[model samples]
Target: MTKRSSPAKTGPQHLVLLAIDLLDSSLHYPGDHPPFESFHFDIHITSKAEDEKSQVLVTVKIGVHNENITRQLGSLTINCTFTMNNFADVVRLNADGQPDMPDDLIETLHSTALSTARGVMFATFRGTFLHHAILPLIAPGSVTEEKRL
Candidate 1:
């Protein structure tokens, strides 16, 4: 697992969902259909803090793959923008002027965004062959650990 940005840990921050956007989505099948042996998930989380606006934009992408992981069965990318109440406290400007956020805060936001995407993905492929290929319930740390910004 790739490490997340290890910035100074700030106290808890209140967040509200500002918006949810479906950035991209697609579904495919390689002859053999659902009820397959197994399914794999590829989850990626990335965030950008808007200190001036006291908001953070997080994108969570959930991709489903076949048992062997050779072919992609479906994918859903959702971008969620959240308004952080204590933006200044939890966010700090790095040397490069990028907003450095705490791991805990990021992990929480990632988890929420992932859950939202999961529901959307499920509804999207409903009644289709990919219906059975649902995004697995993933730990917050495990999801954000893969990638972060």
Candidate 2:
């Protein structure tokens, strides 16, 4: 008789929230002039678990300005929220149960945006794991705009 071995199981509970932060920078339009200003982005990342269908939610807030006029004629604000699924598939697990990021996942996140809107924005984001035990990431805030052109 021969003995049979079973495959190792990777569960969802092993996932953890690593780092969350925003990259805010202004872009100037036309040589040395702030004609059009734009705020960069915000990102939240989580450690990948064993589930291949696990999803992660990312929320974004943007501020826009049109400096073509002199009296702050107009401004725009945008709020965006998106979900990235199958993130766990981009996580590599070592023998010690540590999570490692895959190149594909980084690429996907770098080029992903949730939604966009115009004029002072506020938003709340949440992520639900299907058939798994995972908590959603939530951010509640109001983005305000004040400019004097």
Candidate 3:
């Protein structure tokens, strides 16, 4: 028999956090384009708190997949933090001892979190990777691009 896993303590929130950050991004062109193929990538998120702020780490991994095998192009990651100024305002304790985050507040939090992540991305890309040979061809106009997936 298989045992079920326990639920998360805080559960899931409806208001998704749209954030972006770039960490140590690089370009590795095989001197030319490999082949016509679809792009595949994955995103990972983790959060931690230090002092008055909570650090949200977002990592993006990109790989090119051909008929034979998949090869990693590169990766971008952003290290950001969200400080809870008013914990009670952001998260309320319900009668059942569960945390209740309001819809409006959740939306606001999402925007702020995303902006914070983009800030680091902007700086790193402009300062470090702006003149990369293969960057301008594939890179977006802005650091954080808002596109429908």
Candidate 4:
């Protein structure tokens, strides 16, 4: 899960005809029990949408570590390519007022891609990561941020 949160969009009246894929994912290490103390994430997209049909390549990299600063606990890298038709309203514009892909919407799609990638990653290390690492992070009845992910 990410440290930051994005408000969920429900009853959406904008955007349609979305398609996404997970292209690649790699894991450096699965980490030990209690997993890593922190993680690192990188996300980006390469777009080609001249006719409003966009093909985007999204990537996500996660580096995991524990209290030990020098050694890395684990890492995950993922790549995805998706095509979608951007709604007129959500599209960002250029200097000349010409329409372009919205960076924010692209970012939102990146999260969706990562979510699928993360699901696969967690399933890959079901015994180690799921049981020893992620499950322990949950502390019930604690006042915390919204639980949506």
Tell me, by TM-score, which candidate is best.
1
Candidate 4 residue-wise lDDT, 19-112, digit = tens: 4444444444533444444443332323433334434444545444445445554454555555444333344434443334444555455455
Clashing pairs in 4: 36-65, 37-65, 37-66
For model 3, what is the alpha-carbon lDDT of residue 67?
37
- Give each model a TM-score: 0.80, 0.26, 0.39, 0.46
Whole-model lDDT values for every prediction: 0.75, 0.31, 0.37, 0.42
Give lDDT tens digits, candidate 3, residues 19-78: 444455554344345453443443333332232222222233222223333455434565
Worst 10 residues of 3 by lDDT: 133-142
Q: How far in Å is the alpha carbon of 13 misplaced in model 4?
A: 10
The per-prediction tally of clashing pairs is: 0, 1, 0, 3
Q: Per-residue lDDT for 95-130 in model 2, tens only?
A: 444344444443333233222221112221112111
RMSD of each: 5.0, 16.1, 10.7, 10.2
Candidate 2 RMSD to the real structure? 16.1
Better of 1 and 3 by TM-score: 1
Badly placed stretches (over 4 Å) of model 1 are 1-13, 32-34, 145-149
Q: Please provide the root mean square deviation of candidate 3 (C-alpha atoms, Å).
A: 10.7
lDDT of 1: 0.75
Error of 2 at 6 (Å): 23
Encode model 1's per-residue lDDT on 10-112: one tens digit a residue: 6655678989999999977677543666678887877776666777788887788876647787888888988766776676666555557777777788888
43: Cα error in model 2, Å: 10
